[model samples]
Target: MEISLEKPIQQEVSVTNTGDLSEIQRVLTELLYVPDDKLKLVVVLELLDYFKEKFSQKDYKINFFYTKQNGNITGFVVSQIDKEYRSYGMKCPTFGWLTSKDFLSCKLLMGECEDFVRKHKFRKIRGPINFPKISGGIGYQTEGFEAPMLNGVAFNEPSSKVLEYLQELGYKKDAKYSCVEVVESNWNKGNNLDDDIVLKFLHPHEIRELRSQILTLAQNSFYSVLADAPGGQSRFEEMMDSYDLVFGNRFVIKDNFDPRSISSIPEFIEAWESCDLNKIVPCCPLAYDRTNGELVGIIMALPNLFQLWSKEPLTHLNVDTVIINKEYAGRGIFSSLQNVGQITSRLHGFEYVEGTTIYANNDRAISTIFPHSTPLRTHYVVQKRILRK
Candidate 1:
């Protein structure tokens, strides 16, 4: 799996989906190669572990496609059809984890993906969507290369050349994602929510206990907002698995394991142990209807753990997701949530908050959610219609 740094020649490449861990690991490690970046190395390891786990599952159809030029692995991509994944139709494979040494390698790897899609009789192929959305976030970094890499999102070298290669190979943009950063002081202080809607920030210890309630709020809010769009109902339904993964596993650690002990990564351990739960407040504020105590709005953000690996003081936050029930949309809950989040973050020494992964065309979120925030980075998930249905 040794990758050559020398110039790649235009040669015929062979593709295979061996699902071999050691080979897959070497390919990913070399592809994601960044000098002296242990954090990125750890990320690669985590992604490998995720693949190892998913590959063992009987319910998933996971393929690891790699290209070989004169028997040397030049590039690789992952394609999968999981019951829970539905960016494309269930029968279509979502392709991701793409890397290539050059244009020819990219074409070979993606050609294998198209072959897989057509053999299975799927109408269209969609992605660059690396699943769980949090890990190696969906798509290639087609824009905002100047933006600093943040925790909980994808980061690839600017010289990777995968995006342009895909475009040249005739893949169209399936979806576009953008992130925005707002200085604490610049955040607008909108009118407070009505007296009937109560806003509260959860204590770190209580997050596990209220996890179910929070998940319910997220589900109800997302469904109401998304169910009206084309294929939105199914997409929302499919996204519940991601919601469960976040709230049930990633956000709230199990009661049995020490939270710090759960992660083998030293930086993550340091980040977790450094938190003085009482003093360092997380800005996960929830708005509830006072009349019936129904959760109506939520704004979630967490400390940027990657800052530790960068040898910087933890002064940044990643605003992951914000959801408000349609029933509660116009009452300033969204603005109030952001305002509260800004104050909480500022009080706890966070200087900046980046609202990330917002859909590019979501005008409501772009215009209203973080109005004062400036653009940070952008990503694009690509697709090609393999069959003329």
Candidate 2:
């Protein structure tokens, strides 16, 4: 008599581990049904190479999980005990997987993950997450499949089985956040930016020249949010690599109210990274303080190419990271940046703008951010504690 919850079959689900890039890509191809060209396999390979370059010698751990049924592979999950999780003794190696269509396979794979977690002596498994929380939505989608998959979200409602399995296994919501959609016609683009602040859009041709200032502003601008978190330096490194990829496409604001402000075009271009006058502007924006001459805030975004996976192409944008200086918190800088990224996206032919992981207790986002657009779905990153005996 078979005792496993997984259905009785000639071939039982088992675990095999590998860190081979080709195997990983093969698994991804089996999981994500998209054209090879549109999928940009090279970008993913580049990301893997980047991490390999950074942590090849470190005590980084990676384990891949899969379930094969009747001589065919059906489900897969990749588990990594990387620096982000190891930092500060937070043992949260993330799990990235395609939709687990079979409940039994999902259950078995998760059991293996839990066992892997136990073996590592880490309590509290938090995952089924994408790499780098800033660009990724930080959680799986709980609703909103009618809308097409955007570039930055975790899932598009197909992973309901995994969500169910996590819940059944006692994983509770660590937090819930929503992505609010801002329509171009409904936006008040002229209202949010302060009169004292002059916003500039970075142009593509200026990327190589302004690398240093961009790095400086990026480090200072996000200090409040990222300070003291795990693997902070590695995160900065990731940003540096990613910055060059989207170098000219950015939004920057400088305070014109100060007399010392380098408000002129040449100086502005020299002092900052992302403004150009010749063409349609880019979406990511950085906010600067003229009076104090410091990096005050920033709004970051990236284009979603998931539409390429669909039968019909669609346009989408993800407003991934928005940070306001600790001192500038109440001045509407965050919300303004959100709108600026969204409206800029909308104007540039993007049909929708979305972001997520706004804390449930975030009163500002609840009151100010939610009211600005229609809420499409609830987002969550599920977690469970594993205590040492």
Highest-scoring model, TM-score: 1
Candidate 1 Cα misplacement greater than 4 A, ranges: 1-11, 33-36, 88-92, 119-121, 184-189, 209-213, 223-281, 309-312
Error of 2 at 4 (Å): 26
Which ranges in model 2 have alpha carbons more than 4 Å from their true place?
Answer: 1-9, 32-58, 85-91, 132-137, 156-159, 184-198, 203-275, 279-281, 307-315, 338-348
User: Model 2 residue 95 lDDT?
Assistant: 64
lDDT by candidate, in order shown: 0.65, 0.56
lDDT of 1 by residue, 1-389 (tens): 99889896756788877777888777776666442366767667767777887888877677888888876778888877655454422344778768788898898888878877877777677777665444456567756777656655556667788888888998888778888877444233344447677766555445445556665665565533331111223233333333332232232233353534433433223333444433324466667787998878877675665565567776777777677887887777888777665654554567878887787667788877556777878888777888533
Per-model TM-score versus the true fold: 0.77, 0.71
lDDT, residue 123, model 2: 76
Report the error of model 1 at residue 187, Å.
4.7
Candidate 2 lDDT for residue 302: 57
